[model samples]
Target: MNINLNINNKIYNLQVDVDEPLLKTLRTLGFKSVKSACETSNCGLCTVLIDDLPHLSCTILSVQCESKKIVTLEGLSEEVKIIGDFIAEEGADQCGFCSSGFIVNVISLKRLYPDIRDELFIKNYLSGNLCRCTGYEGQMRAVRKYLEV
Candidate 1:
């Protein structure tokens, strides 16, 4: 199928397979940040923003995103850096395999709830994104630090 998708504020013309996951489509288009640890949406490593909300790219079909706006980690570099600085300072960023998805979700969290300051609420908001290394405490601390700024 041939479709036009608005990704990272740019239009892309792509010919994709009917059953191809958006994760693969995006990687094919050089959006390497959209990685996949589990294609079943459990890992959240393939997360991307669909109309400003986090969605597992591995579970979404390329054709389904034809008319929607998609934002990958590449599109939100500055926001990523804003949060990443805290994550790094807090020592939450480890291995870096899940950084893209984790950062994307963090950005979404802030956008979705601008006034969020509760630690529990922040934890629950990012429950879907799993990182094997830091065990979440560092990430949580990083988020708290970011929110304070």
Candidate 2:
């Protein structure tokens, strides 16, 4: 089966099974930055920006994402560098498992809420992602600094 997808501002013709998860299809298509953790939607490791919003690729079907602009962490190299530098400065890259997903979400949040002003709001929004290492403090700090707060 051949399907057309717009990933990271590029068009791709993916030949994959219809039941394959978007995550698998993406990785097969060379989008390795889209991490695969929990196959279910529980983990945000497979998070991708769909239409500028964070969408878990593990939960979305490849066919359903035919026309959406899919932006993975690899696509956000500049933004990730900014966030990664902050994380390294704060010694936040412990396991490095959740960094990609967290960064994607932070980018999306900043784009959506340019003038956000609430600590609790930040905490609540990032709560969906889990990190066994580095804890949440470093992630929070990275977000705060990125948002210039």
Candidate 3:
């Protein structure tokens, strides 16, 4: 079946199965920035903004995404660049696999809780995402920088 996908403010006609996960469809459609790690949703690598909220693309059915505004890392390139600059300054970006999802998650969190500043809160907030590289210290630094901005 065909579904309407609103991505980065542009609409596209996506022909996909209703049960297909949004992540698969996204990757097939060229949104490769949406990383796929642990398709069970344990890893936040598949995170994407759906209707302005961070939703795990690995678990979300493609049909549910129809007519919804889906924002992937490609769409958030400017924000990711800003975060990347901060990550660079903090010596954070390593492996780069989890960067996209983490950045997207941070963007969503910052928008949702603009006044959040508790380190513990930030740590807990980012607990869902797993990064094998960088050891999370750099990740924390990047998050701190993002909050400052």
Q: Which candidate's TM-score is highest?
A: 1
Better of 2 and 3 by TM-score: 3
For all candidates, what are the clash counts?
0, 0, 0
What is the clash count of model 3? 0
Candidate 1 displacement at residue 137 in angstroms: 1.1
Q: lDDT of all predictions, in order shown? A: 0.90, 0.86, 0.89
- TM-scores, in order shown? 0.97, 0.95, 0.95
What's the CA RMSD for each of the models? 0.9, 1.2, 1.0
Candidate 1 per-residue C-alpha lDDT over 25-125 given as tens digits, one digit per residue, 9 for 90 to 100: 99999999999688988988899999999999999899999999999999998888889999889888879998899889988988888889987888888
Best-fitting candidate, scored by lDDT: 1
TM-score of 1: 0.97
What ranking of all candidate models by lDDT puts the best one first? 1, 3, 2
Scored by Cα lDDT, where does model 1 land?
A: 0.90
Encode model 2's per-residue lDDT on 13-119: one tens digit a residue.
Answer: 87878888999998888788788998888878888999999999999899998888989988999888887898888888887888888889988888898799599
What are the runs in model 3 whose C-alpha is more than 4 Å off?
none
Supply candidate 1's per-residue lDDT for 37: 88
Which residue pairs show collisions in model 1? none
Query: Which regions of candidate 2 deviate over 4 angstroms?
Result: none
Superposed by TM-score, candidate 1 places the C-alpha of residue 6 at a distance from the truth, in angstroms, of 0.6
